[model samples]
Target: MAAENQTQVTEFLLLSFHGQPFLFILFLLIYLATLLENSAILALVSLDPHLHSPMYFFLSHLSCLDLCYSSVTVPKILANSLRPQATISYSGCLAQMFFLMWCAGTECALLALMAYDRYAAICQPLRYAHLMRRGLCVAAAASCWLWGMLDSALHTLLASRLSFCGAARLQHIFCDVPPLLRAACSDTRPSRLALHAASLFVGLSPFLTVLASYLRILLAVLRMPTATSRRKAFSTCAAHLVVVALYFVTANLNYNRSSSGAWPVVDTLVSALYCVLTPMLNPLIYSLRNQEVRGALRKVVGAQGTLRLHS
Candidate 1:
């Protein structure tokens, strides 16, 4: 029943890292930190009534996204660390790629919306509440989710068509676009262009949008009469800016790779930033910087701390 052009791949051998034994313990620590941080963020965001604001709303979603995104790969990675070989089934690899792309793209759009929210808050302070009304914020978040679903669905469709004749090894820990394309036996021109175009649209376009928004925000901040007000505005956006900048820098370095001269280790290091380290620290950064978040976290902790004390 298999089409001659379409060879069914039963499984893929994942090359997470080659011959690096010591890295396992380091990666375990990083994975645990990422999981705990994301979990803490989600709990605080969901449980803390004080964090019921547009900014923390998006941060909650981002934390949840990071948790899901990392989960698609990390547990398997840790499991493989306990063993020798790390292999995943073909359908599972496809699913992993779809989920990973969906989460990353959604996070990209979410960051842009969060930046726009900050712009509205700081640059047009009076209009902040009216502009970022609960309905609109909910709509914006829904749109990001829909866009992510659409992107994942399209890539999955294209991936379904590709044939894998013989080679089964995937060069990365997860089933990424590049490694999957390389592993395919059939012509992968369509898949490559579609995925890369999605990357440029989803990845590069957001970069430009963030840049433009921040430039306008900068101009507005410069015009403010009080240095104190300007400083306060800057502080609010600072953590978000840091998170976005760190994310975009590593993400671009990873996805914008050229086939002409590929550097695996360099890409690995950069990918690690976005994949492992960024998610691990994002919630902590925001919680530390934002008083509202801090208050909410305290409330959550105080409530729990009280429960423990009473028990």
Candidate 2:
């Protein structure tokens, strides 16, 4: 009982964008809206059969990833908004780090899968069916989880070696690797190297994959016979392109830099967009833009109303 009690770290301290009093309400609105919109998208995708496709398969997973990614930081920030002081236990911090990395890594792989799906659809329409079959979709989604798990496992291992001997305060909003390393009490060279390697493997690799896939997609789109077909394909790629750009910009800034603090607020805001709004907008951007998704949504709503009336 004593050992167990001693081992259980109670809470963690969160540093907001910058101890800002005015930002709370704005952040609250953003978090609330993101949750609402992302939730609706996920519900609609699951309920509407017509929305089932390689695109939606990827979209649904992205919705889920957004839910998770946003969840890591926002609730705590909201709580801090309501309270004057915010704190978290060591265990809670560890859990947050694990889960956040898990979701982020998964998003990396999932995005790559989405790009591949687009590549297949645009570059090889005749064989898209055989290529992106139900089994393949499931396997691709499973691979995302596996990759995330692998990332989290290695990170956790590296983090355990760190000792919390210095200032307990974490500067960032969440328990990110660099900030966490700054707080560690003991040597963290191994952990830092491990994190860098993981970044290259889990983060940079996906960016390259998406880039190559999009390059091919663009070439394929250009070769299309009709203007309408080109427009439709570009539209499909547009939202993803915007979202991916947002993620890579913020993420690369946050990670790729060795040391910099030119604009923390701007960085925080961009990070929040990738972590929060991107996830929120993914389903809406994709589903609303596509006619098939809207048709599916209508059918689902109609079916539900009919069922309720009959009942």
Candidate 2's displacement at residue 27, Å, is: 2.4
lDDT tens digits by residue: candidate 2, 188-239:
7888787778778888898889988998998888998999999988876776
Query: What value of lDDT does candidate 1 attain over all alpha carbons?
Result: 0.78
lDDT of 1 by residue, 1-311 (tens): 33563545678888665357677777778778888887877787788777788987888888888888778777777676566787888888888888877887898898788778878887788999999999999999989988988888888888888877765777777677777777777778888788678778888788778877888898888888999988987775666678788998777666656651265566557767787777777777765566776776678778889999999
- For candidate 1, what is the TM-score? 0.90
Q: Which candidate comes out best when scored by TM-score?
A: 1
Query: RMSD of candidate 1 to the true fold?
Result: 2.5
Worst 10 residues of 1 by lDDT: 1-10
Cα error of candidate 2 at position 267, Å: 4.5
